[model samples]
Target: MAEEKFPINIWVNEERYEKLQTAGLADMCEEMLAGLKVIRVYANSAQRDKILQVFPTAKFDSATTKSIELLPREVKDAIFGKVVEKRSIDILEEFLGQY
Candidate 1:
């Protein structure tokens, strides 16, 4: 089975492109660019690079960069909240065990 690929259209500037390059997600960024007009789906990272090679001038938006930056924190917070809740339960169990 092939991995699922989501198509997204976004505008990107040089700063955001640089950030993508720095994070080694340039291929992913390129995939977004290729998705703008092409119906082609990228099945792997290699395909993303190929799409970028074909569409080197694809654009990116700052909002996309901002959202990407924020996504990790949002995910982390959600996971951290669950972890803390679990730890609290464990601590309560330990306390009750002592009694």
Candidate 2:
């Protein structure tokens, strides 16, 4: 069976959106809420496990989209930066590798 994927949402502002567009990743924004753009990066089971291990404060928000929530702003910004640099949403494994 395919593994369940957990989401890590990165909220985008105009500056971040411009960077995403330049990185050719603009189409990755799947949802926009209350004038904010959201890009949901998926994490497979192993990567999700790594994230939980690395960030003890993080938890899955099952009440919503099963997203890995409560991440600090700096961490989210770092993740977003990595996404733009790599021009891909498949960044959880590599990003977690730094921890």
Candidate 3:
């Protein structure tokens, strides 16, 4: 068995921000980095982390010291919606064609 780990940082969207204030910087980072999709800071944050929208795995690169935009929930939800809408259909189609 082996132990694996990665580091990550998360922030909020400013412009056009309908962002929920989940947890503060520290708590957000902790939960977001740990691969938790929902973030409720101080047990009372209206904000939600969009992490699960893309990476349901909740895994991220905390170590990369690069400026990464905290993707908006709207954008993520839209993308997820599009993909999910077709995923089952695509899977069935592919399986049927394999015969």
> Of the candidates shown, which would achieve the greatest TM-score relative to the real structure?
2
- Model 1 over residues 1-99: C-alpha lDDT tens digits? 875442222334555455445655455433344543211111234433433343454322235431212223333243223323443212222222322
Can you list the residue pairs that collide in candidate 2?
none
Prediction 3 TM-score vs. true: 0.24
Per-model tally of clashing residue pairs: 5, 0, 6
User: Which of the two, 1 or 2, has more lDDT?
Assistant: 2
lDDT of 2 by residue, 4-70 (tens): 9988888888888888888788887876666668988899878887887788898988796788987
Q: Cα miss at 24, model 1 (Å)?
A: 0.8
Model 2 regions lying over 4 Å from their true place? none
Candidate 3 wrongly placed segments (more than 4 Å): 1-68, 88-99
- Which candidate model has the greater TM-score, 1 or 2? 2
Stretches of candidate 1 off by over 4 Å are: 1-7, 31-99
**What's the distance in Å from true for residue 84, model 2?**
0.8
